[model samples]
Target: MKASHFLFFILLLCICIPASAQEAKMKKIFNGKNLKGWVEPANKACWTVSDGVLLVKNEPAKKGAILWTEKSYQNFIFQADFMMGDGTVDSGIFLRSENDQIQIGISGSLKRDLTGSPYIPKLRYPVEATGVKDLLKPKDWNTLKIKVIGNTYTAYLNGQEVMTYSSADMPPSGPLGIQLHPGNEMSISYRKIMAVAL
Candidate 1:
């Protein structure tokens, strides 16, 4: 082959090789049979593998108990199917990285009765919760989708765009975790846990 033809071929091969490697890096976080690549947060008793889904039992916590992946993820799309009991069952999904972490999912339902009644938390603060999104359907399964690029995050619930948050403190690469809201007898299950790196 001529010099120019040989040079062109080499450059094309260089670009194609990396693309193939990138595709292999994306993997399903769950095996759909067992918990082989995941780690329970501080609470193991509340989280278990039942049948093919990862079940989160009702065990309240002071802050939030997490079920995070052992491996860290950078810019990727994380998807999971979760089920909650009532409007009382609150939870969160955290995307961790080296410096910054993005939190999504439903933590608690809208509680308007606490205002001017007795006490008020962040949810019941004087102003409507800014970071807080709308409530999810109670006692049913919901699909949460999170897309993280660099330090920015965009989240979706049940095929609807909920909110977008960005930060410099966000971790560029870290494990994905689910928060087990403290102080509730809540049971949640997660199936089809996966991450595809972009």
Candidate 2:
């Protein structure tokens, strides 16, 4: 082959290699067909997949059940689309087990909407998000992005930066969970759950 052609080939390979590696690094936690990678909770009837979306009917008897990821992660980016129906929808995305969770819908008390809020479940204190009221769509799908690096977490709602906070109490690694907070009969759905480790 010509020297110029060989040099161009090398340059092309340099650009293609990183792109392929980056694509391989990202993993889809949800299959959209079934809960294959999720550890099904005791109240299995509450969770189901329909038309490639995970939904919780929120039965009163089966509240507060979390659909947990079988695998755990640390220092990663998680992206998903979620929607909640009318009435009080109290749901959250649990990071690092049951402690650190990004609140998605409303709290039962009706005091805090908590969309895009970074909170510690045990502490009951949330690093509240700003400019989120107008961003969140009621009874409609909203995109949520969360990046956790070490003890620091940054979250966004519908492509808008919401909040960033650091916590020393969170574990280095733990399973990600979707919570159906107890005592509410509100429907919630999640889809396109994708994650990439940093």
Candidate 3:
């Protein structure tokens, strides 16, 4: 009805544009309600979710890895907050497929002397760890951020630079998986998993 009021309304609409645009650009891979389009390792009792958090109950002496998302991503930044327990736990965030590709995982504090097989990144990182979690408290939450671009990856744990390296050339596309290694009495929790495309 008034010019100044109209101008103020237009300004308000413009101010909200970028905020909504940013939200729209981000893709939430996990629904946080339940597992959908995701896969769990056969006979795995280690993975669960509560209070918007995915919980992996510690199981010992047998690998109980789980892969959460069915869809794959390339050139993205993945961020997750984790809380893990004792008894030397080792887990990883896998990129591209259940049967192929690289993984970013924990070493030391967890005392995981991981030996890789004929896996993709394993060929390049045989027995080498990309991340270490000594700074993470046994009973507290830790933040993790990983950047993946064309087989090159960098990971940060608890705001510390834990790893940075590049693997062999991959397919340039595929899904993502979350893995919980066996041989530890560790309860692992993950939430606020956010990813952005590059």
Candidate maximizing TM-score:
2
Q: Model 3 over residues 6-76: C-alpha lDDT tens digits? A: 99999999999865665466666666877766766664567676678888766555566666676668887
Candidates in order have lDDT scores of 0.61, 0.84, 0.62
Model 2 per-residue lDDT tens digits across residues 34-107? 99999999888889998889987677674568999888888888889999875578888888877788888776
The candidates, ranked best first by TM-score, are: 2, 3, 1
lDDT of 2 at 67: 90
* Model 1 lDDT, residue 126, Cα: 27
Q: Give the range of the ten consecutive residues with the poorest summed lDDT in model 3.
A: 110-119
Error of 2 at 30 (Å): 0.6
lDDT of 1 at 55: 76
RMSD of each: 8.3, 4.7, 7.4
User: Top model by lDDT, which number?
Assistant: 2
lDDT of 1 by residue, 153-198 (tens): 7766766765565564565678877767676555667777777878
Q: Candidate 3 — number of clashing residue pairs?
A: 3
By TM-score, is 1 or 3 better? 3
Please tell me which model should have the higher lDDT, number 1 or number 3. 3
